[model samples]
Target: MARFNHNKHHSSTTKLVFLISCAGLLGAALIADFLWASSSSAAPAYLSIASSWALEKSGILVVQNVTHNIAHHKREDVKDRKERIPERFLPATFADLPAPELQWEEMPSAPVPRLDGAAIQIKNLLYVFAGYGTLDYVHSHVDIYNFTSNTWGGRFDMPKEMGHSHLGVVTDGRYIYVVSGQYGPQCRGPTARTFVLDTETKKWRSMLPLPAPRYAPATQLWRGRLHVMGGSKENRHTPGLEHWSIAVKDGKALEKQWRTETPIPRGGPHRACVVVNDQLFVIGGQEGDFMAKPGSPIFKCSRRLEVVYADVYMLDDEKKWKVLPPMPKPNSHIECAWVIVNNSIIITGGTTEKHPVNKRMILVGEVFKFHLDSLTWSVIGKLPFRVKTTLAGFWDGWLYFTSGQRDRGPDNPQPRKVIGDMWRTKLRL
Candidate 1:
């Protein structure tokens, strides 16, 4: 054999430079092949074949490159939600879940018509607490529905004069904790009227008052604590994002020292909030962070701020509020109702904004179900009727909601009926 060109005079550095150049050329070829295969309409087998032959020694590295490419493609797909068909990928309720045998059942009506009430189920009993009545009157009517009997039980009025509608109420089976709500003749409050009812004893007693008066707010119990979130403090216009919490022993409160946690990014006059898997979900809410340039009359005079949000937010265990995917459009459903069941969060009813400036305004009857794991939303179905300002709760296996309002509106010019009928949808989720 001809004498090998083994040049002892060539330093190690020269060898390194030559090796690097060879490696770079190989890398450039691999990249070009990858791009050509990806961009071209026809699939080419040359890249894999060449890579396998040339980079055989660095097979592990080649595998890593493939993995990285896959990960990058997945990230791109995730960013574009429109590319996802949630129904094909996610279950309406639970993952890998079979189709639900769902049915709707009509139940006994409330003795009187009411609206803006809070609904909660303690064991087998569904309680419809204080709400606004006909003639724009505040109601203390407390109605109980027995799922076992499929009938309405004896009606009970509130112990004291119940406040205006949109009060937050949560129960730990034994006690019903009613938080701040509105009252007064002008429908003007955001009152600190806090009351607790011994469900077993049927006795209502005053408990720790709310830190501030809030109206049209939402509350949920997470890990033996009550999380109160979002509502107007002064008026419906002054939406609040502040959140407060207090610990409880079993169902009863253990101590009274309530602490405020990380507030929500935006606040709205009407927002629905709930806790699932230690995450707080706020939906169909709005945020009015507008200010009138410091000293303008709009600022000094406290002019109404108009803002509506179709975005949804979740507060996690780290106390961080994360913005989830927004509604299909930007119209804020002014009075929507939401409930968490199985593997999804479903929001229903509520009309869109009417103002011209809020162009997304559209009366919504579509029910959207958000699959928790996939982080995707699907229009599972629509409401039978356009329902707004309705209270929703989960009892047994049914989602109890409103029927048709017999006209809960103006009785003079047009008789807007109040939907006093109780309807429950049984789900085998």
Candidate 2:
């Protein structure tokens, strides 16, 4: 019963140790396979829970950590390979390409052929007001165009006393404000009478008259105030430097008297006035204007030697006029030819400096963009033909211009033809 064999006992112990080692290796192999499979796809919920618990209890988390490290290294290797590839082999992306060419489409023409008319767009309707029509007649009727239907809806008569040309028109969505302008044709003396029209009711109400009459004045609404700036005087030849404003709400003036503000640096008429980011900007105008014959009974106006300027001035929150970068070229007759697109003000057709050789009026056909952020100017594109006094409107990413004096052709320098034809182009920017 007490017989002790050293060799036999040693052999039994060795066999037990070998079996234990084999079992440990087998368990490790199973864990490695499970880890690999789990990494590729989701494991069963119960299996995941059991494995987590077993790892914690058996202190085998180091194995899982090692497996995770190997997978991380493999991912790093793939990323490194991608990074080493040359960029020239990659396919070109849309952002790397140039913008597509813009195409223009012809739309229905306006009922009346006019120039220097004020166009204000309200929703789908474009209201074209008093302009110089055929035979030098000032149109007193308002033409309503439904852009959705691409047709002229109808016409309505303006107030009998309302001025016909050089009228500074601005709309506050519901009401259309018509400021000082020549009451009749042939550069007649301007009228101080100011009128506001209720677009919904198609009725006109008289507002406080301007302190002084102005022809083609730069007028715009800013911060609940109606601002009326430089324009031609009663003689129609002198540029008024006076800047005036009156507190206005809805279509009526709140103050009894017009308040005088800082005068514009350079006074002129037919300038493009716009309010952007609470700032008022005046761009591209002429210093001189057409003058009336001294002894004429009807006071017929005659074209005077005028100088067009590219100067740009801005009135900021400080209420001080700051000189901005001038336009790329001298421009005028842009009273109603400008539209705001994003951060830039795009001006369509307008008058530029006269030709140096022939001294004939030069019309601008290229669309000009004034970036508000950068305070820079750029030539974006050109109109089908050169034009001046163009009434411009923007809606649904489309830029529309109608009723302007158009040039004969691309080679022609004179813009003698007044067109009622409407044209529109999709604006990418």
Candidate 3:
């Protein structure tokens, strides 16, 4: 009986050694499978069924052997992995939602012809103030679109022509504020002019000027103050992060104050900015003179790409700038087409570098909706028209944008013709 037992033990040892050898060979194949799967080289050929089965068998073997031999080690590895990840790496917005499900509805038209100005939404009314039109400079032109009525009407013209305004218009739920629009002989340049129009009075009053001149920047309401971001100054490029705050009485501007807050790390003209829950987001604009430092001539279009930044930036509660993941592709010339839906942002069409470079710029009608929580972007349906450098607003489950310039440029030797067309979009999510 002792002899038989000894032989049996030896046989069992031999079987164990043979299994270990097979496991090692399978492990090598498994490693090769992972490497090949993750390769960035030219696309790899599809794995054969036999090879796939072999890989699966090897994975099972490895997992089973590790589970049996190093259960404690696996537990420690998971713990270490959890500890190593930064909190920010986890989903921040919408608690890591996948994508936003939203719908859009179209609006009728804006009452007047305005371009390169600013837009603000108050209650059921959208007030577009002080923009250029078929005429070179028309300041003090205020057009109001009523959401409830699907109509447009307001003070048609101001005393002065406001030209090349920063589009830095904002609202406090009542009056619409227009600040630092260009006027006078330098209608095409920046101006320190500012104004506020009372919805009740339907009249415009000159308010304090901006500390510096700005043209076609972005403005929003945050922390009970109207915050403006990004635009150009007179004869100088302003990729500004300088934040200005204006005090408002129940959405009515009563006084103004300016603060040179953190400048945008990356700045450009015609960028689109919007705020969601007090967090400011800036996206899509022409990268002008951003590379220029003091004493150096600005390089306007150096690092040109077909599309540039699909990335979105967030200025969170900490007042620190965080680079969220970028969009799938970079786009520019996105005016104010940014709108919020289901806590996410919808970024519509803008001119790509291909457009300006090839002189084939179109008013893009495509929409890219970004999910704040999931850090993902999905391409929604396209708009009916190619709208760029236009004013867009969201109200009553619909989007309204108007007064963008569309032109036959160097192609026809004809100067750019500013468009006075208004478009409404309805998203079906």
lDDT of 2 by residue, 1-429 (tens): 234687778889999999999999999988986676566333332254576565457543311322232322132356554554211111111001122335889999998899878888788888998888853578998998886777887799999998888889888899999998888877678899999989999989999999999998999999999999999888887889999999999898999999999999888799999988888899999988778778877667676888898899999778899988988778899989999999999998788776543456767777889988899988788787788888888888899999989886754546788789899999987
| Candidate 1 local lDDT, 211-281, one digit each (tens) | 88877666777777887887777645677888888887544567776788888787765666666666768
TM-score of each: 0.64, 0.75, 0.62
Residue 426 of model 3 has an lDDT of 64
Predicted candidate 3 versus true structure: per-residue lDDT over 250-301, tens digit per residue: 5355665566666666665667777777688877665442222334332222
lDDT for 128 in candidate 3 is 70
Return the top candidate by TM-score. Answer: 2
**What is the number of backbone collisions in each predicted candidate, taken in the order shown?**
10, 0, 28
Q: Is candidate 2 or candidate 3 better by lDDT?
A: 2
**Model 2: what TM-score?**
0.75
RMSD of each: 19.0, 24.6, 17.3
Error of 2 at 5 (Å): 99
Of candidate 3, the 10-residue stretch with the lowest lDDT total is 87-96
Please give the distance, in angstroms, between residue 402's alpha carbon in candidate 2 and its true position after superposition. Answer: 0.3
Q: Candidate 1, residue 390: CA error in Å?
A: 1.8
Error of 2 at 107 (Å): 0.5
Quote the lDDT for 162 in model 3: 43
- lDDT score, residue 105, model 2? 96
Best by lDDT: 2
Task: Candidate 3: list runs displaced more than 4 Å.
Answer: 1-112, 135-139, 159-164, 184-187, 236-238, 246-257, 289-308, 354-362, 407-417
